[model samples]
Target: MSKRIDPDNRRRYFIVGSVILEIVTPVFRQRLEKDYKSKGVGCLQDFINSKPVIHILFHLRHTNIKCCVDSTNCRNRRKLPLNYSQWDLLYTENPGPPKHHCHCLYTTNNVKLDDLDVTLASLILLNCCNLTPNEEISIKELREFKNNYLSHNIKGAITEKEYQTLWNDLMTYVLQLDPSKQDDFIRIQNRPLDDSLCNKYFVCLLDIHKKLEEISDKLESSTAEILTAINGQSNMELLTKLEEILQYVRCQSPKEKTDNHGIKQQTPIQPYKLGQPIVTLHHQINLTSVVNTSWKVTDISMMDDGRLVMCLPVQSRLLICNTDGSQVESIHVQGYPWYAAAVNNSTVAVTLWGIKCIEMYDINNKLKLKFISLPGIMRLDSGITAINNKIVVGGENRLHIIDYQTGKVIQTITTKCNPGRLHGSGDRILYCDNINSNKMYWYSYTNARHHNLTLPSPPWDMTILQNGSLYVVCKDGSVQHVSSDGKQYKPVKTLQTTPGCDGIHYNLTQRKLMTIQNKNRLVTVYNEI
Candidate 1:
């Protein structure tokens, strides 16, 4: 009389176990061996056998960790004292007379790649090991996967879409660590999860749960001692230390409880309010070297992977660039490309000028997916955004919502003036008509109402921040900040450009803003201060 495990949960459990055991551990082992060998240690096993105590002490000192456990308990438990420093969860003392015992974490007088687990491997990589930039990013992402996803997933379940997304992200990280193991990972992902395999994975899941609980207990027991250690520091330094401590504590905390309907209720994120603008120039990329000097970037959008998609009307192409404006690639479109919006991680929807068609392209493959033709709308320009699996297209004096999959117009809204540029989030759509008015309009999908906010000049392009507030680039070489509800506004940043700023995009993940200026030949990036 036990509840049956959900199929999705079984798959998730299998993925988690196989990824940690089959991929992560081996990669960590390889890196550790390489790092030690480069330091003249011969091999990892030789290093561990020769200087176990030194190895443990070196890492503790490297990470600036100190043991807070009492001396009496430390002696009884065979733990290091406060002077030698200790990370209780990471290292342990060898079985011997307490005074003569050596502390070790990697392995006890032996090194076996199969003996390493996700937690131990991750700790070693993050705290004690040397890593390249790519390897560092990959390991940190894997750590986040453990802290955020696996620890909180009490049910061991994931939806189909969630599984695909997680698979792609984790695979990317795995390849970054060691590209040769791609086939091994693929086999693990495709392996069938029979009942025996499920049971084994369930045992691994229980062990992870136990480890998480131990982490939480240690954090709770050491908070007071940690705070005391940071006493007398400057207020800013103290606050920063406290915040870091709290962040780790929160990550180790249990998952939130579900409501009556068995759905987890998440606290809504508060929208950022406009204040004295704290923006600084981060980078300026001149596109004149890559493209014709006269060709202009009429619009810009940020993809999920942090790349920028820009519209080149005169060139009739879509220009793609890395987050730093490197690795530039161009896709030729059939007509003049006036605007572009990212539909998903790999897809972008482009609006062609003087054509009543919206072209969806797979940027990764650099090929057109489909064209959605609007019957009544004669032309399309810089007014397009993807929201809730639908594409909102702006035409002469109206907005059309088209189903991206079916290529059918599902809803239409008549506007008082022409809609030029559009952006949407959740149930709201914001648009501006640079030709007809200097006013921006916000439309509610649920209530079917319109709200307007007047600006100093016509708005050319806009992007929303994580908190729902917007950064709007205007026709007067100025950028404005507006509240979520469009009730308040302020001028935040301005560009020194003639013919005004035509394109703008905010990368919420990076907290950076990209704007096109100098007739779209110069691209300026700003960091949020």
Candidate 2:
């Protein structure tokens, strides 16, 4: 037997629709306006008002019907996509769940209209409702107006009595919602919510507003102290706290930073033509034979003063070498050092394979300062690079940018695949993915855009030059000279060693190509041919 449309079903549909129309629409409008403005478009209100409301209405109505249908079909077949992750399955399934899936918020099945009174208002204002919090509602008057049944149900199936109650509540809330209050509007938008995947987003958002007000009182008195700590070198804890605040502010009120000088103008993505090497190799310097490491060189970094830093993975040792095929100083670290990068004249940043932290070391003093902890990070096999005092550490599907001095994570950049070796030059960070079938990615910090380049044989390690050209080592014993844009590539040279070809580096000052032959235990340096 087909399920009867009950009063409870009608109530849920009405409340959900009312919440979306009153609360959610403004949030969507604000987001759309900001997105348009960032892309250098204008006429914000016109664009927002002209957005197809019919689609939203239809979508909500469809979702409501789906929920009711699914509830009825629950005895016949289990409703699969009732949770948040399976929201995509809604359109595909015959009797789908609601689009929002806000049923989890309410404890009871029979929620009275009076119970949701404060919640409705709070949700609207918090979700950036274009309504004043102080706007009063004439409950008695609205109840009377609702009894008259001003609007008919879209389905025309629900009884007039049931439809009137839903309509009355919706109309009352809509009338009271006024967005003209500047102070309330600013407060609702600026506060940052706890965005962990486990926590309920709406609950966290409300809690953050309360917490921020308390924090605001303390910050006013300690303004100078807080500022000094944020700027200090050893204040890692303070830096992390400040970075959290910075992240919130940037997300809430993101304004495009325009450069009037045009010094940092974006380079047009030119069609890459693969040909001969711009710089050829003259001779090879065998440095790996001196350092008796059984394993491969996972990472390599060249310092400003022409010293080379290389990390051996299984050996757990960092070898410091000069221009000649000689080791300067070799030191052992705690965990399996997967990657290393020269941060400054005296310091180097090292990330481990099994560890969730990046260790910053004072090489001259021979002491470890502090570890920069990466929260919820995993599968960090190798890629590490330093660009503008920030070290970009690669994990499974994201590149984490950490401040070298402060040990604070500045930003997390998502990727298409797991990153392997990283190379930074000027404003660009180039990295090759472990997956994606030998594809290289060029990420621009200036424009915050990523472009992909196809490569032959999965690239093990890569080095980007000052002019944006790349020298990449392949797993199939090939070293290719790839174009800046990565549209084309040419095999400049081929390594003799097969299974051990890994970790490529280019010394800027000396203009030499350095690569590791892991099985043969050799670090080969080739002078330009």
Candidate 3:
């Protein structure tokens, strides 16, 4: 019998709206929408339950992507969810009629991290090239850990007893990063040591792309030889060696660098032309707090029904206020909440520290619906967003996609570095990695990482507009505008605050940019381009 390649062993999948899609035939450009029972838009649960095949040939080597949603399985038609949400307090419900007027409000300034693992828990201190003593020691420890654990295993050091020991140590490191663990192993370590090291090592490996390019040259030559051996049928043993080498070479291909901003950039579908300002400041508001305690505005969003939601991490409240910043209603939750997003007009998902779970709450009733516990030490370092009826959250190393209804983790996307504040639009996910000097990584739904943008300063949070423009608030008090093409980005506006900007949002219905200042405790509004 001929050796069979198991069909079920396929590795990658994509959840588009209510559809579960996998590239069934990579070469033929065919995709299979995994048949599921649900009729409405597919959620993360559908993706988790479906068996799919992963086709590596789908990986893109050029800037142009040649892929499409196979419509054969798309039985239901639904609106492609808005990239940015809308809010209009005057109209009482979200997605209300468009108004030309701009509004701003003061948000809390007492931002505090309840745990070390939450997103933006600590801003990376930069400007100096050398590492801190503690940071250096942590990096050294990471090298030792990798060698003692992974390196030895790869080198054939796998006795059953040794394997168990290695597994235990790996789990120990994972647990320490998990929010549920509060014992001595976590307390004395300050921020998770493993996380710190991982981020540092990633930065140190910035030259990895250069190495990959060098290896790609060798791989090309070896592949040609392998093809010849296959034809001759004489170099079977040599062919096997070449295949092994090719596998390792294919791992991390060189990502193209297109801009001076950071590591790599992709050629935009349509590059932006440099020109006059497309957006300008419209209004500013200085808010006075109703509560006596200090608070920090960590994240912001517009609900479908037009309410403005801001996450007060220190206050453990999801502050809902009108556009003009009057009369605020708050929902209290246990532990400190980092960020929040609207699942719908009536429901919101909040990422919590200490508890280490993302909780879904009924915003109208202010009732806790249920919580989904995180697996391993996955830290939701970035606040959460609802994309295509699923929760999009990220930490240092990965992005977690969860089913909004079930609180089940449907899929996880690995990131290049420690991803902090992130925003999602359709299949494109944009995130900032403070550990890598505030590098912005853009990931498409089909592939792992698409492109990267380096910012002048560490970014606190980002918001995407309806037209695909990206607005990022940096620690340097400047808000940058990246054109839809990703080729042009400039400081569109500046804040007078010292500590600089933190939370940001782009209201699609109103066509405005909303940003919160960490130092001044003020909110600023700008007319969109």
CA lDDT, every model vs. true structure: 0.66, 0.52, 0.48
Write candidate 1's Cα lDDT for 333-393 as tens digits.
Answer: 9999887888876689988898888899977567899998776553755489987667888
Which stretches in model 1 have alpha-carbon errors above 4 Å? 1-275, 378-382, 493-499
Candidate 3: 10-residue stretch with minimal lDDT: 12-21
Looking at model 2, the pairs that clash are 130-179, 131-178, 131-179, 132-178, 280-529, 281-529, 282-527, 288-523
lDDT of 2 by residue, 37-153 (tens): 565546333322222321222233234332231344222223321222112211222333455432221221222222222323232223222323333233233323322331222
Candidate 2 Cα lDDT to native: 0.52
How high a TM-score does candidate 1 get? 0.53
Report the number of clashing residue pairs per model: 0, 8, 12
Best-to-worst ranking by TM-score: 1, 3, 2
Estimated TM-score for each candidate = 0.53, 0.47, 0.47
RMSD of 2: 25.5
Candidate 1 lDDT (Cα, whole model)?
A: 0.66
Candidate 3 residue-pair clash tally: 12
Which parts of model 2 have CA positions greater than 4 angstroms off?
Answer: 1-293, 379-382, 494-500
After TM-score superposition, what is the CA distance of residue 402 in candidate 1 from its true location, in Å? Answer: 1.6
